[model samples]
Target: MTADARDLARWSETLAGIARTGMAFTESLYERERYEEVLHVAGDIKAAARAAADEVEVEREVDHFVQEWMESIGEGVPGYVTPKVAIGAIVGNENSEILLVQRKDSGIWLYPTGWADIGYSPSEVAVKEVSEETGIECDVSRLLGVVDGQRMGFSRFGMYMLLFHCTATGGELNPHPLETGDVGWFSRDELPEATAGAAWWGSMAFAAIDGEQAPATFDPVRDAIWRTDDT
Candidate 1:
């Protein structure tokens, strides 16, 4: 199906409205086969706007389009639609041993992390997750990186993850009931069989260890596999 320039302009304008309100666009609005159509329209609008030579107006429109596109179909809820936030922590001890948790539901060993709740910032979400999962009090230090866990299938609810470097402030390591079965500190060399998905372990660890500020979004399906310096 061919998308006309007018259609593109209209979609672009609609997207701008969506961005302004932070509204989620329902996937049900368009069938799966129509995704390509939408994408084509978006591209045409972008190209025409760019070719117009009105740089400022074009940029504004492009920014609006990008923001709206992200707000609508960026991440969370593959088929339906919703906003999701996730948090990950680089929790370590005085011995520099990083803490890991074995989740009860998935039986995956991952860093203490979970979805961001309604009333918390991303950092607060990380701290809350750490405390809830490991019974540890931690102070969020710095943002290690943000990763798109959606493509990697690490996110259960199609959420994006914000990873943080954290310091254990107090409290002992006590696994949360049912949510986590085990909690342990592992040295860099003595990592456990991670119950968390491979992508989470790989990306979170690399960002924390190397102190890299990765892109805010990474689609594992489109991006290359996570690789360490040696790899």
Candidate 2:
């Protein structure tokens, strides 16, 4: 009977983005007032999610989220709120092994990934992340998937992950001191028990590694776009 914490967070963020964008383009005083009210509601929703997730009583500081959203508002095109982008590499070697890194922050194993850098292309970010996090040099072969990180539980915030299929070119299994706890080649059957989002991406990744020609994957459209998980 209760909304999931993640669903609450998602709804709160979506509402906050809408309010911020409305504030950006509207000059009418009444519309501005309404948008501000929406921001307050969004803040309440976010605070609720935080409380639920932490399993503790949270002080409902609606003003904090409102101020944060208000500060992020920009003029015109830049005001359009969108999910952040991250790039991931599914690097495969000649032995049909995938390169995975144990994230230092979470201790979960996943393909090498990082936030998209300002100057580099998406594919370039994937290559850079692989080399930096796992010390694996790889050439991108093709795109594997474009995944919604929130839906897949890879991130709490809205993020789009550009997953690329890559072939290992060189380098040894040297994990980054700060970013990765460990790094190594793993066969499909040998993935770590703590592998993140394996159900959502495992098949696609291993198929790519095994030389299967499949189109890039994405989340399918929901029948009710705005419906909550409980519905």
Q: Against the true structure, whose TM-score is highest?
A: 2
Q: How does each model score on lDDT?
A: 0.62, 0.87
Predicted candidate 2 versus true structure: per-residue lDDT over 1-231, tens digit per residue = 134787888888899889888888888999999999999999898888878877545564667778988999997778888899999899999999999999888899999989999999999998899989987788999998898887766576779999999999998889999989999889999999999878878898889999999888899998876787558
Give stretches of model 1 more than 4 Å off: 1-83, 197-231
Off by over 4 Å in 2: 1-3, 54-56
Tens digit of per-residue lDDT, candidate 1, span 1-231: 122333334344343333323323344544433553554455446556444533435534555545445455543334234336778888877777788998787777778888788888888888888988898898877876666543443332235678788878899889999798899887776777654554446555645555455544444342323322233
lDDT of 2: 0.87
TM-score list, all predictions: 0.55, 0.91
- Residue 59, model 2: lDDT of 65
Candidate that scores best on lDDT: 2
lDDT of 2 at 24: 86
Task: State the displacement of the C-alpha of residue 158, model 2, in Å, after optimal TM-score superposition.
Answer: 1.8
